[model samples]
Target chain A: MNGLKVIETQDLTKVYGEEVAVDRLNININEGEVFGFLGPNGAGKTTTLLMLLGLSEPTSGKARVCGFDPTREPLQVKRLVGYLPENVGFYDDMNAVQNLLYISRLNGIPDDLAGIKIKELLKVVDLEVDPRKKVGEYSRGMRQRLGIAEVLIKDPQVVFLDEPTLGLDPDGSLQMLDLIRSLSQDKKITVFFSSHLLDQVQKISHRVGIMIKGQMVAVGRIEDLAKEKFGVGQEKYTLEEVYMKYFKEGLL
Target chain B: MKGITTICRKELADHFSSTRFILLFYLILMVSLVTAFIVGSGLRDELKDVAKPTFVFLMLFTSPGKLFSLIQFIAIFGPLLGIVLGFDAVNRERSARTLSKLVSQPIYRDSVINGKFLAGLITISIMLVSIVLIISGLGLLLIGVVPGPEEISRLFIYLVISIFYIAFWLGISILFSVGFRSVATSALAAIACWIFFSFFVAMGASVMADAISPVDQARASLNPELLIKHEQTRKIISLVSPMTLYSEATTIILDPLRKTTQSILLMGPMERLSISRFQSPLPLSESVYIVFPHLISLMAITLVCFATSYTVFMRQEVRST
Candidate 1:
């Protein structure tokens, strides 16, 4: 646990009844880095994120975001982080601008800055098509973009995106990926995004952690981990191959 | 302050933008209008039968007496509106996976619950005002007489009391919404609870009272009217219901000027012979005082439910998945 790290989890565990949803997970994510959290379905990626976001209580151990204990100082931690949820729903009756404005206000952004920030964020997400159109009428990809725009409104130090590209079309997915990359690079924002898409994670992430069966099995630079651990050597091993090899060898 | 205001604005927008509000508004409008028409027609028929046509002003002044019957109708559905509007309030956020997004903000969870409660309260108040205006307008137009200041004051009191009554149901709905994960489950729970409190509880109380009371049915049936009077005892028993408390409160408000003057001559057994029992109706003011405890209880229960929801929401996990 150092000040340089934006997120640190030590032996963090979450149990639902007799099932261990997340077990003894340890992670450290540095500031201003695009950290990809790659995991299969039910691999505890979401559960871990929930704990880090202070949205769920861990059964045991410690987790901190921005040097504040998430469970104890959730509000303090929340003030420094922005989270885009998996489904990313807004009040469907509200338009993009209204939704962003509401989220900005909730995050305690000052009145004057909130308007300017909303406009900038909306434009950045390419959601400049009628701001007055109700969100219910928005396509899945548009809602996702609006959700991303909402998370960015407060201009927090860290932004967490959970499967942000899960439901998008190919064009929307590409656009979203570009937007996420640009947001991190241009704004110097620490991006901690989770996804099952290995190729996307490989393309965008500074470092990637692959989680399997409630444990962080691999964590390092994508290229270094592929070359050092998998030994697919000289030629690049796609993240999917690395994921498959690790699971096949039961290394996870 | 900003967080609270944000929640409030979002909740208000959602309330107004949803088709549910439009449907509820129309339903209430149609119900009130139909009620006004039926009652107006009945009053017209009653006037025709009178030996002498009194001044229309006197008839309008006394209109509350006839309008009191509609109290049952309004009381039955008023809380229904509150429950329906509020049942999905919290659950929808969870279902849509928005709860986590909202909670992840720096805002306190209490603000979400408070904003929602306020929005529901405001919506119900608006609906009540619209219904009252419609009823009052129809009264003035068809009866061709405006209500007196005292009558209007009573109507305002009735409106306030009705709002409080509906608030009770709103609180219950919020409680259900917090307690249940599924919107359908919350709604079903709220509606079921409403039915139990509104109707079943009263019936249950009457049945229990009938079994517990020491009245001998055979002797009481000597006079057919005595049987009818004994049945009236059931009404007193049913007053234990919360719905009855609200209905009685409305009755007091609507008939605030009712006088308690009566001459009764009753025959009963006295030393195996005759004894007389006579009683007069209590004045409306005194009746209001009597029901004050029940009104307070209803309001307290509403606050308690709301407080429970707030606490539950504060502790809730807002995981988006």
Candidate 2:
């Protein structure tokens, strides 16, 4: 539970009253790896992340993040793990500095250090704009970048991004994908993000977990999954083909 | 604890800078001051005829202004302040898609609600205290009279009561904000409640009283008993509105000579003569004793509203929108 595996889930389950949203999800994410979580809508990718982050409770299973039980040690987990929800937002009336300052203060970062970190983070994210510009005036891509800066304020060991490249133009998505890739490359931070498009996730994801109907249907390196699904001796199918096989053949 | 303070400070800044808050605040301040100025000018000569004006300073709040007294104005419109501040408290975060990001941070969920509520209460208290002080200062300048110790204490009590009264509405608006998902829906719902309690309740009370005790206006002299019953029923029914409770409680506190909320003028002369009339002002303790139920109910409803919102918000699903 505490070695190279930064996140480990043992049959993590989540049920919302009558329906099971995440059913017995088990995933092992290694340290310093870009783990892509792929699923269609209602596939419970966000719910799994919620349970992993301790924002939600698992119905009958357990999850551990950074060697701490999320449900019991939520503060420690949250302190060390950063989450960027889909379409995340900030106070529009305030500028980037004020918004990030609030978040840093919430994380117990001192004012002097937080100021320095905010400046450095703005530089690192390439959010080059006037300091007086309010977030309301920021373009969608700029807001996403500011979101990355906000997530990095606490210097978390693990960062979870739900649909990081969603709703962005081609150029914005490319920039976001690059930034997400560098999250693990430059900082050695574990980047666990969820996406539906296989083409984009296949580019930067060292390993990926594909969920279908609340179950993890395929998990591992894309090529390894292709080989495992179609057999090594037979013809090799593409990653997209391997992903579609689960839905195409009604394979559970 | 730090999380709570952080959120509270942020919300306070937001309230002070919000245009909606500033507009409503200035409206209340202007109306209250103008009412005090007009009423203060009118009461100078009227109070001179009295033998000994013990709590004349209290008249600035209790005396009838051009339209209504300061106390009545607050009773009628204070809910608007609370509602506007809190109607969109939670839903705004939701619609802006910031609630998920906020909850994901290293803070307890209760901190969000607690911080918003505490900030709102503080803002209301600050506004109420300043308005009272400003009006009192203006009244002093106009009438050339300083407040006595008893009058100051009464004003303090009045301030505390006004805070809770407005806080009760804040709790209500926060409840709607938490219960409803859309900002417009919650705002409309809170305003609807404000209308119901502020205006409709008064009308409904008389209708209910008439139904309970039918008093023919033409033959009312023969059945004074029925007329008295009708009046009692109307007052009882009106007490259901928080506005009624607030005005009644403040009237008792500000005008110590007010022994009861009931209309003694409707009583027969023989029956009225039997009742004791105190020409002098009653003690503060006696007035407080008479309105104990009003104070408790006001407080109880406030706690009930905030508690409901707390439980609901905590239990809700935090979905990423």
Candidate 3:
């Protein structure tokens, strides 16, 4: 309630037949805040992102993204939110510029504006390859950089990156983390990035939300979460320890 | 609608540049032109004055160019054009992890499938039209005869029908792409369908007809009525395949002299008794009217395919995995 609530889910739930992928989850993400969503595999991180982006419908409850209900006004919501999926893909035969151009057209950006924007965005992502080189020729790191550029094409207010650093090397991961940090710092874009890499998430996020078994087990700044767990006397607990703490409890 | 056009343009560009499309296109063009050349030479050498054929121009398509007629070649190979274009249309995006990024854009979900189908139909039109035009030009050069307005219109109709026939296959491949997640699985399923329609339908139809209306060879010349029933049953069952429908429809469309698809067993006793049953080609209108039912069936199946894919794609969850 202290800041403008850009994303709010009220008892949001998603079910696949008998399986509950996300169970009555409720969380609020504020404007201009880098919120790291932490979870292991099959912890409903992607299912939650899909619902927020209107790519998948929720089984029950309501969720609003940028104050727009994703189910009812998906186009409006989509226009304002960018998403970079895990191991993002591009048309292998087309060059980065061409692929971005296609996405630009899909977003209804005019040719004149899109041309200038693409050049600038490519530079911003530091992808200095040949414009004619097909994406198939790109290295994995370059493709991931292009994914970031692809996300920024529409100048979205918020970006949801689902494990953007999954397959990158140490150097690539550092570069990716920098680009993600810059997105929130310079562009004032609210970034909700999900990752199991506890160290990486700890470096950039102002606040973190931990989910276990389709439920939000903890949500707060690192200090507050540490204090609540170890009871007031501890200075802090590493994100690894905190994740382990809840993970063990959830298993039991 | 803009989303549909944007996606369509991208898909068309991709298809035109793809190696598979280029190879299939060249194969079709070379085979078709060679067939026209052979047929044209045969027509030119024949005595024009002796047994003059009405539409010598139309013979470029229906004549025994080499092993089979041009229409027959298309009947066998044209579906490959559509299948190759569409078999991986949706599944490729899924496997590559692009479906999530694509549907996340501001466009409606149906735009992806609609645009792909439209792009496929356009590509089919372009390929078929070019082939038809090149053959017509070759016919003019090889056989010194100009196609009349009616002949031109008949060629035009044949081109339209050919586009729709191949489009039916495109729809099928796309339907498989939407239904199956694996590109190889969808492609295999599509090729299997093509094989069944191209070869097995005829074999199945023959077997079914034999069971429906048996022919009694023991009766000798006493009754041709039983033979007629058997032939009619075979034709009806063959109609199940789009390949059969396309071939039969184009047969009458290109050759008006072809009076009936049924066997001579169905000839009425009164007509058979006549000494002279003079042969004359029907008008173009009559030919189209005769094949109107076939065209309807071809179009209906194509729509069914595209509609099924469209619904499935829209309903599918745009997941990352």
Candidate topping lDDT: 3
lDDT of 3 by residue, B100-174 (tens): 899999999998998999999999999999999999999999887899999999999999899999999999999
Top of the candidates by DockQ: 3
- Deviation of model 3 at A152, angstroms: 0.5
lDDT of 1 by residue, B41-141 (tens): 56777787766443333333235344444567678888888987799989898887778788889977678888889888988898889888877788778
Against the unseen true structure, what C-alpha lDDT does each candidate score?
Answer: 0.77, 0.90, 0.91
Q: Give per-residue lDDT, candidate 3, residue A233.
A: 69
Which ranges of candidate 1 are over 4 A from the true structure? A1-3, A110-113, A227-236, A249-252, B30-68, B133-153, B221-240, B257-285
TM-score of each: 0.83, 0.95, 0.96
Q: Which TM-score value belongs to model 1?
A: 0.83
lDDT (tens digit, per residue) of candidate 2 on A110-180? 99999999999998888886878999999988999899999999999999998878788998888888888
After superposing all C-alphas onto the true structure, candidate 2 shows an RMSD in angstroms of 2.2
In terms of docking quality, model 2 is medium
Q: Tens digits of per-residue lDDT for model 2 on B141-206?
A: 999889989899999999999999999999999999999989999999999999998899999999
- Judging by lDDT, tell me the better candidate of 2 and 3: 3
For each candidate, what's the DockQ? 0.63, 0.79, 0.89
Candidate 2 Cα deviation (angstroms), residue A58: 2.0
